[model samples]
Target: MTFDATFWALIGLILFLALMIYIKIPGKIAEGLDKRSDDIRTELEEARRLREEAQALLAEYQRKQREAEREAEDIISQAQREAKAMATEAKAKLEAYVTRRQKQAEDKIAQAEAQAVQDVRTRSVDVAIQAAEIIIADKVSGKLADELIGKSIKDVAAKLN
Candidate 1:
């Protein structure tokens, strides 16, 4: 009995499989796949490491920024305190200067008042002497009376001055 075309095709298929096995093609394919997998795993690990490093750098920069902001606030507060202190000192100086000037003005006013009182007193004394001399000269009529009046006027002037 002769083989049919179906029977020959089955034999050819079996030979092709056997040849593939003999050449170890399946094992080679599996090895290539494993090597590719290892390379991918290594690249993945490197990527993870890079991500961690970037996160650390970001945290460090954020910390530095916070510190800088704190320093800036401190500087601003210090400046404000100093400005207030200077303003207070200036105000104190101005008040003192005003007080001194006011004191000087008061002293001058007092001096002027005293001088006016003294001038009025002196004028009153001079007028009283003139009136006394006129009355005495009208009432008296002798050299002796004139000498006595002159002496009395000199004594009154000396006491008043």
Candidate 2:
């Protein structure tokens, strides 16, 4: 038989495949690929768990923020109501003070007016008595003067009464 190039190439290919099988290289490659796939799956599961935990924390913080906002509003509303009540009470107190001062001033004025009227009446009475004494001294003499003076005094007292 004559040896050819194609026949020799075929024989070389068969010998190479036999050497690979004897060494178990295909089984080792399959095992390495399977381990890499399992690592990738574990990493994906860990990433999913971390994402869920982050989402839950964000939701709890949001709820706390809403509660804080409501508490702030309530505090502001209560402060406003207290301020309004204080203002109303202050206004009432101020009005009462003004009214009391006004009444006191009026009473003082009335007392002053009454005192002035009394002074005028007393002055008039003194002037009248002096005039009567001067007229009686000029117009009469002795016992007749005394009698006229006594009669005039009685008439003036009765009229005053």
Candidate 3:
């Protein structure tokens, strides 16, 4: 039989396959594919683990945010309470100041009234003494006048003291 291109090509293809089998190329290829698959599985597992860690971190941050909010609210409440207390204290101080001023004014008024009463009493006493002296001068002799004037002076001084 004459060897043709198709027959030779078929023979070459068979030889190439037999050479590959003799060298265990198929087994090596299977092993390479299995190693690649295992690597992909490991990467997938690592990605899953990273996703879980990220979720835990997210939860921790959320808890922290809630705690911050609570603390802020507490601070605000405390500030409000302190403000109210300050207002009450200020009001009390203002009331006490008003009372003290009113008391001082009353004391001043009382002092002025007392001074006026004393001045009036002094003026009345001087007027009465002048009237008595004029009457005594009109009615009494010199000796009797002197004796009466001395006794009146002594009596007036005693009453004043």
Best by TM-score: 3
Model 1, position 36: C-alpha lDDT score: 96
Candidate 2 ranges with C-alpha deviation above 4 Å = 1-24, 125-161
lDDT of the candidates, in the order given:
0.93, 0.88, 0.95
Q: Any idea what lDDT model 3 has?
A: 0.95
lDDT tens readout by residue for model 3, 89-159 = 99999999999999999999999999999898888778878898899989996999999988997888789
Q: Per-residue lDDT for 25 in model 2?
A: 80
Q: Which stretches of candidate 3 lie over 4 Å from their true place?
A: none
| Better model by lDDT: candidate 2 vs candidate 3 | 3
Clashes of each: 0, 0, 0
Structure candidate 2, residue pairs in collision: none
Q: List the pairs of residues colliding in candidate 1.
A: none
Off by over 4 Å in 1: 1-35, 136-161
Instruction: List the candidates' TM-scores in order.
Output: 0.64, 0.64, 0.83
The positional error of residue 66 in candidate 3, measured at the CA in angstroms, is 0.9
